[model samples]
Target: MSKEESFQNSVIRPVIKMLHDLLAVHFKHYMATKKLEFSQLSEKEKTNFIESSFNKDMAFRSEIRGLVIGHFSTEEFLLYATMQRGINKRINTILKERISSNRQNFVE
Candidate 1:
C-alpha cells in the first residue's frame, strides 16, 4: 500500500467507518419519527446506503448492495445514521462560514 493508504488503514479508515456506523443509526431513528422517506433522496431510493456501505471496501457505494438497501425498510435503527450525517453537514457548513468570516476579519 502507498504511505497514504497505509495511514488510512491504520487511522482514517476506522474513524470514518465508526462515523458511518453512528450516522447510520441516527438516520434510522430520524426517519422513524418522520414516517416516510425524506423525499430529497427519493431518486437514490435506498434508505440505508450510507449505513450499509460503511463496512464495504468502497467506503461508500456499490450497486448490488445499494439495490438491496433500497429494499430495506426504515426503522429506529436505520434513520439515525443518516440523520447524524444531515446534522453534521449542517453544523460543518455553519462552522465553515463562521471560520471564513473570522479569517476575513483577522486579515482586516
Candidate 2:
C-alpha cells in the first residue's frame, strides 16, 4: 500500500483502536479494584474524575475523543508511533544479545 493508505489503515486506525482498548481496560480494572461508586459523585465531580483519569496528552486526547467525544482533532499520532518505535528498538537490542550469546552455534 502507498504511504497515505498505509497511514490511514495501519497507523491511524490501529493506534486509535489500541488507545480505546487500553483506556477501557484500565477503567474497568480500576472500577473492579476500587469498587468505584460513580453514582455518588456530583456532575462536576464526575466530569473531573473522567477527565483527570482519561484525558491524556496530545497523544491520547484525540483518539478517545474521536469515538467518544464529538470534538476531535489531530493530536500528533506520530508521537506515539515514535514511542512504539523506541520499544521495538529495545526488543531488537535484546534479540541481538541472544544471538551474540549463542554465536558459537553458528561459527564453524
Candidate 3:
C-alpha cells in the first residue's frame, strides 16, 4: 500500500472503528428504549429512521469532523475523507445485509 493508505490503515482506521463501536452501543440502547425492530420497518421507514438518528446528532458529527481535521494534514485529511467514504459504504452494505437477514428470520 502507499504511505497515505498505510497511514490511514494504521491510524485513522482505529479511530473510525472506535467511533463506530461507540455509535453501535448508543444505537442498541436507543433501539431497546424505542422498541425498534429493524425487521419491521418498511424501506422508507428504515431510511427515515437512519436519517433522523443522524439528524439528531449534527453536533456530534461536526465534532468528529473537526477532530479528524485537526489530526491530519490537509492532504492526509483528504485521503482520510476518501477512506471514510469507503468505510461508510461498507457500513451501509452491512446494515442492509443485517436488516435483510432479520427480515428473513421474521418471515420464517
Name the runs in model 1 displaced over 4 angstroms: 17-21, 29-44, 47-108
Single out the weakest 10-residue window by summed lDDT for candidate 1. 99-108
For every model shown, the clashing-pair count is 17, 0, 0
Please provide TM-scores, in order, for all candidate models, with all chains considered together: 0.26, 0.32, 0.38
Could you give candidate 1's per-residue lDDT for residues 3-94 as a string of tens digits? Answer: 43443344333433334434344445534544644444543443243333333424223322232233334642254344544433333333
Q: How many angstroms is residue 27 displaced in model 3 relative to the true structure, after the best TM-score fit?
A: 1.0
Clashing pairs in 3: none
Query: How do all the candidates rank in terms of TM-score, highest first?
Result: 3, 2, 1
Instruction: Please give, for residues 1-48, the per-residue lDDT of candidate 2 as tens digits.
Output: 544444445444444344544445544454455565655767566556
Runs with alpha carbons beyond 4 Å of true place in candidate 2: 1-14, 18-22, 54-108
For candidate 1, the per-residue lDDT at 106 reads 18
- Against the true structure, candidate 3 reaches a TM-score of 0.38
What tens-digit string does per-residue lDDT give for candidate 3 at 1-108? 765557656666555445554445545555565688866779778667656654565553454344434556677667667767654434344433433334333222
lDDT of the structure predicted as candidate 2: 0.41
Q: Name the best candidate (by TM-score).
A: 3
